[model samples]
Target: MIEVRNLTKRYGPLTVVDDLSFTVQAGQVTGFLGPNGAGKTTTMRMIVGLAAPDRGSVTVSGRRYADIAVPLSEVGALLDAGAVHGGRTAYDHLWALAASNGLPRRRVGEVLARTGMASVAAKRAGGFSLGMRQRLGIAAALLGDPRVLIFDEPVNGLDPEGIRWVRELMRSLAAEGRAVLVSSHLMSEMAQTADHLVVIGRGRLIADTSMSEFMRSAGEGTVHVRAADPGALALRLSAAGAGVREGLESSLVVSGMTAGDVGRIAAYHGLALSELTPQRASLEDAFMELTAGSVDYQGVTS
Candidate 1:
């Protein structure tokens, strides 16, 4: 497991991470989410000892990353896929990292094949595409088969197939009882990939919850109803304290009430209903609402 308790980081006058705390448990994928410049990368760096936190602590299995004798075997991370030497081959890059960590050289070929880079293992790092580079980075992270893994934007430039591949790979890693923390801007993908979420904005924690609970706490979902007497039903629902608004095709969007309540009200009035659907807020909707005020920059249009 990975534990970050009140983790804080600063640079001169600017604070990049502020009192952040979350746990990435084994056997699950915890998605680290935020807007641009939300300090996600900085937090990941702090976890791996790339940057020292000004305060608080981050530990793997109850030990600071620096304290772990064989750090790679305890925690693996892919912060920047392009941070490797451009002149080296994919195979050479992993070899160097393994050597530095005192890991076996045989793991090199295993990870190359595991990340589907076996065919291009000899290709120079500078010549690889972004997706291929991502694969190589992941291969390096898996070099030690660590129990904790951190991946920052692993699918940044991947195609649909590549994205699916990464999704499955992360799932499999979690299934193998490893703590997986992934950071991404893709809401749709995160919805399907992550079991838990740590959302932040403007260097502060916004929310830390499971996917289902987050959606449920986003307030009551609006109910869409298509009734035989649309006009009469709207008035009755409005009178019953439901916020009613016109919807497409002679339907009413009723808020501040549940679908069961709406259906019962329509039935009491003897109004036949064709559709009574509850529209829950999606992940993107909830994220936008939660982080609306914390965006660093906003484009304005007149």
Candidate 2:
């Protein structure tokens, strides 16, 4: 488990992280989320002691990363794809990481095998593709076999298949009882990967909750229904105080009523129904919906 307390970081007049505090529990992948320039990276840096916060601290398990002896055994982190020697082979890179923490050289090979980089273990890191480099970085992190893992955009530049590999890897790590904290702008992948979500905007904690809870709270209830008589159903439902609109070909979107209610109403009116289900918003939609107003910088649409 990791605990962050009152973590605040300021750059002269600019405050990148503000009074952030949260706990990342073991056996769960907690998403560290925010829009670009929302200070997610800064907070991650502070957590691992890459940057000192002006007003607080972070601890892995029980003590600060700096004070934790054999840090590699305590925490494993992959912050960048370029965190390796260009000329060194992937195996050598992992070897160096293991060496730094007095880990066994065999760990390098083990992690390489675990990360599915055994074939490319002898390849130069510089020539590896982004996905390969990511795998290599992960191998390095796992060389220590630490109890906590921190990955900052681990899926960045990964192709679809590679992305799934990383997602499953994070889940496996969490299942094995390691505390996993991953930061990503990819809400879709986070939705499938993370169990807990910590959302930050403008460098402050906006929401800290379980993935299910967050989705339930942000996913406003709506009913999706398909019927042969679309026009009749919409009119009838609307008249009955249900807000209904054409959803798709022969479907209607109904709000202010449950799916069961809509189904019963349709049955009462003798309207043949095809599909009747509650429409839950996608996690990406839910995240955008929750943090839209908190976004510090909006992309120019022009």
Which has the greatest TM-score? 2
Candidate 2 lDDT by residue in tens digits, 169-211: 9999999999999998898899999999999988889999999
Clash count for candidate 1 is 0
Q: What is the TM-score of each candidate against the true structure?
A: 0.86, 0.90
Q: What lDDT does the true structure give each of the candidates?
A: 0.93, 0.89
Q: What is the lDDT of residue 260 in candidate 1?
A: 98
lDDT of 2 at 288: 88
Give me candidate 2's TM-score against the actual structure.
0.90
Please give the distance, in angstroms, between residue 76's alpha carbon in candidate 1 and its true position after superposition: 0.9
Candidate 2 weakest ten by summed lDDT: 215-224
Cα-based lDDT at residue 3, candidate 2: 98
